[model samples]
Target: MADTGIPHFCNDLGVTLIEVGSKEFMCIGAKPPFDHPHIFIDLGDDTEHVCPYCSTLYRYNPALAAGEAKPEECVWHDDPEARTAA
Candidate 1:
Protein backbone atom coordinates (compact mmCIF):
# COMPACT_ATOMS: atom_id res chain seq x y z
CA MET A 1 0.00 0.00 0.00
CA ALA A 2 1.07 3.58 -0.65
CA ASP A 3 2.18 5.69 2.32
CA THR A 4 -0.53 8.26 1.72
CA GLY A 5 -1.55 8.05 5.36
CA ILE A 6 -1.09 5.99 8.51
CA PRO A 7 -0.88 2.22 8.04
CA HIS A 8 -3.68 -0.14 9.07
CA PHE A 9 -1.32 -2.40 11.02
CA CYS A 10 -0.68 0.56 13.29
CA ASN A 11 -3.10 0.35 16.21
CA ASP A 12 -4.13 4.02 16.11
CA LEU A 13 -5.09 4.13 19.77
CA GLY A 14 -1.78 2.73 20.94
CA VAL A 15 0.22 5.73 19.83
CA THR A 16 -0.64 9.36 19.29
CA LEU A 17 1.24 12.04 17.36
CA ILE A 18 1.13 14.59 20.09
CA GLU A 19 2.75 17.96 19.65
CA VAL A 20 5.37 18.36 22.32
CA GLY A 21 6.65 21.77 21.30
CA SER A 22 6.42 24.00 18.27
CA LYS A 23 6.24 21.88 15.11
CA GLU A 24 7.79 18.91 16.92
CA PHE A 25 5.50 15.94 17.42
CA MET A 26 6.13 12.57 18.97
CA CYS A 27 5.48 9.51 16.85
CA ILE A 28 4.41 7.27 19.68
CA GLY A 29 3.79 3.70 18.54
CA ALA A 30 1.34 1.46 20.29
CA LYS A 31 0.80 -2.25 21.06
CA PRO A 32 3.24 -5.16 21.15
CA PRO A 33 6.10 -5.82 18.81
CA PHE A 34 6.29 -2.02 18.92
CA ASP A 35 8.97 -2.69 16.40
CA HIS A 36 6.75 -3.02 13.33
CA PRO A 37 8.36 -5.29 10.76
CA HIS A 38 6.86 -3.67 7.66
CA ILE A 39 8.69 -0.39 8.20
CA PHE A 40 12.26 0.15 9.38
CA ILE A 41 11.34 1.91 12.66
CA ASP A 42 13.43 2.21 15.75
CA LEU A 43 12.82 4.09 19.01
CA GLY A 44 16.47 3.79 20.00
CA ASP A 45 18.04 3.10 23.43
CA ASP A 46 16.23 6.05 25.08
CA THR A 47 13.11 5.54 23.01
CA GLU A 48 13.48 9.16 22.01
CA HIS A 49 11.75 10.76 19.04
CA VAL A 50 14.04 12.67 16.74
CA CYS A 51 12.83 15.99 15.44
CA PRO A 52 12.79 16.29 11.68
CA TYR A 53 13.50 20.00 11.80
CA CYS A 54 16.15 20.14 14.53
CA SER A 55 16.93 16.44 14.99
CA THR A 56 16.35 16.72 18.72
CA LEU A 57 15.54 13.31 20.13
CA TYR A 58 12.95 13.64 22.85
CA ARG A 59 12.15 10.53 24.85
CA TYR A 60 8.67 9.09 24.62
CA ASN A 61 6.88 7.20 27.44
CA PRO A 62 7.49 9.87 30.05
CA ALA A 63 7.51 7.07 32.58
CA LEU A 64 10.56 5.46 31.09
CA ALA A 65 12.37 8.78 31.17
CA ALA A 66 11.36 9.10 34.81
CA GLY A 67 12.20 5.49 35.62
CA GLU A 68 8.86 3.99 34.64
CA ALA A 69 7.90 1.45 31.95
CA LYS A 70 11.59 0.83 31.68
CA PRO A 71 10.76 -1.93 29.27
CA GLU A 72 9.71 0.86 26.83
CA GLU A 73 6.31 2.45 26.04
CA CYS A 74 6.29 1.85 22.33
CA VAL A 75 2.71 0.65 22.46
CA TRP A 76 0.47 2.45 19.90
CA HIS A 77 -3.20 3.22 20.47
CA ASP A 78 -5.84 2.66 17.79
CA ASP A 79 -7.33 5.75 16.15
CA PRO A 80 -10.71 5.00 14.58
CA GLU A 81 -11.01 8.45 13.03
CA ALA A 82 -7.66 8.20 11.30
CA ARG A 83 -8.62 4.80 9.86
CA THR A 84 -12.00 5.97 8.59
CA ALA A 85 -10.47 8.91 6.79
CA ALA A 86 -7.80 6.71 5.24
Candidate 2:
Protein backbone atom coordinates (compact mmCIF):
# COMPACT_ATOMS: atom_id res chain seq x y z
CA MET A 1 0.00 0.00 0.00
CA ALA A 2 2.99 2.30 0.28
CA ASP A 3 3.50 2.37 -3.48
CA THR A 4 6.80 0.58 -3.28
CA GLY A 5 6.11 -0.48 -6.88
CA ILE A 6 5.63 -4.04 -5.72
CA PRO A 7 2.57 -6.20 -6.00
CA HIS A 8 1.62 -6.95 -2.44
CA PHE A 9 -0.41 -9.89 -1.25
CA CYS A 10 -2.63 -7.66 0.84
CA ASN A 11 -6.28 -7.16 0.03
CA ASP A 12 -8.25 -3.94 -0.06
CA LEU A 13 -8.48 -4.03 3.75
CA GLY A 14 -4.65 -4.15 3.96
CA VAL A 15 -4.54 -7.66 5.32
CA THR A 16 -1.90 -9.74 3.60
CA LEU A 17 -2.43 -13.41 2.98
CA ILE A 18 0.21 -15.58 1.40
CA GLU A 19 -0.43 -19.11 0.25
CA VAL A 20 2.73 -21.06 0.55
CA GLY A 21 3.60 -24.52 -0.73
CA SER A 22 5.85 -25.51 2.11
CA LYS A 23 5.93 -25.32 5.88
CA GLU A 24 8.96 -23.12 6.11
CA PHE A 25 9.11 -19.71 4.45
CA MET A 26 10.36 -16.17 4.79
CA CYS A 27 8.34 -13.00 5.10
CA ILE A 28 9.74 -9.69 3.87
CA GLY A 29 6.76 -7.80 5.33
CA ALA A 30 6.33 -5.58 2.27
CA LYS A 31 8.26 -4.31 -0.70
CA PRO A 32 10.96 -1.68 -0.39
CA PRO A 33 9.98 1.68 1.15
CA PHE A 34 7.67 -0.26 3.43
CA ASP A 35 9.81 -3.31 3.85
CA HIS A 36 10.78 -5.02 7.06
CA PRO A 37 13.64 -7.32 7.78
CA HIS A 38 13.11 -10.75 6.25
CA ILE A 39 11.88 -13.19 8.83
CA PHE A 40 11.92 -16.96 8.47
CA ILE A 41 8.88 -18.82 9.71
CA ASP A 42 8.05 -22.48 10.02
CA LEU A 43 4.52 -23.70 10.13
CA GLY A 44 5.54 -27.01 11.70
CA ASP A 45 2.34 -28.70 12.76
CA ASP A 46 0.17 -25.69 12.16
CA THR A 47 -1.56 -24.81 8.93
CA GLU A 48 -0.73 -21.13 9.05
CA HIS A 49 1.50 -18.56 10.71
CA VAL A 50 1.67 -14.80 11.04
CA CYS A 51 4.62 -12.51 10.54
CA PRO A 52 5.42 -10.45 13.62
CA TYR A 53 6.82 -7.55 11.65
CA CYS A 54 3.87 -6.92 9.33
CA SER A 55 1.26 -9.22 10.81
CA THR A 56 0.88 -10.92 7.47
CA LEU A 57 -0.79 -14.27 7.72
CA TYR A 58 0.78 -17.09 5.70
CA ARG A 59 -1.08 -20.27 5.02
CA TYR A 60 0.07 -23.57 3.64
CA ASN A 61 -1.86 -24.82 0.63
CA PRO A 62 -1.26 -28.39 -0.45
CA ALA A 63 -2.66 -27.64 -3.86
CA LEU A 64 0.20 -25.30 -4.55
CA ALA A 65 2.72 -28.14 -4.79
CA ALA A 66 6.23 -27.76 -3.54
CA GLY A 67 8.02 -24.84 -5.09
CA GLU A 68 5.29 -24.41 -7.67
CA ALA A 69 3.53 -21.23 -6.64
CA LYS A 70 3.12 -18.71 -9.43
CA PRO A 71 4.53 -15.23 -9.07
CA GLU A 72 1.16 -13.53 -9.16
CA GLU A 73 -0.25 -16.02 -6.71
CA CYS A 74 2.42 -14.99 -4.24
CA VAL A 75 2.32 -11.28 -5.02
CA TRP A 76 5.82 -10.93 -6.39
CA HIS A 77 7.20 -7.77 -7.91
CA ASP A 78 9.88 -6.57 -10.28
CA ASP A 79 13.41 -5.59 -9.37
CA PRO A 80 13.65 -3.25 -6.39
CA GLU A 81 16.53 -1.31 -7.83
CA ALA A 82 14.50 -0.43 -10.92
CA ARG A 83 11.48 0.56 -8.88
CA THR A 84 13.52 2.74 -6.53
CA ALA A 85 15.33 4.43 -9.39
CA ALA A 86 12.03 5.52 -10.83
TM-score of 1: 0.21
Residue 76 in model 1: shift from native, Å?
Answer: 6.1
| Number of colliding residue pairs in model 1 | 18
Q: Which residue ranges in model 2 land beyond 4 Å of their true spot? A: 1-13, 67-73, 77-85
Q: Candidate 2: deviation at residue 29, Å?
A: 1.1
Candidate 1 regions with alpha-carbon error over 4 angstroms: 1-40, 53-57, 60-76, 81-86
Error of 2 at 43 (Å): 1.1
Question: Which ten contiguous residues of candidate 1 have the minimum total lDDT?
Answer: 17-26
lDDT per residue as tens, model 1, 14-68: 3333222112223333333352333323444444454353233444454322222
lDDT of each: 0.35, 0.61
Per-residue alpha-carbon lDDT of candidate 2 for residues 1-86, written as tens digits (9 for 90 to 100): 34432223422234567676767655666555566776767788999888887787778889876543334445544466788688
By TM-score, the best candidate is 2
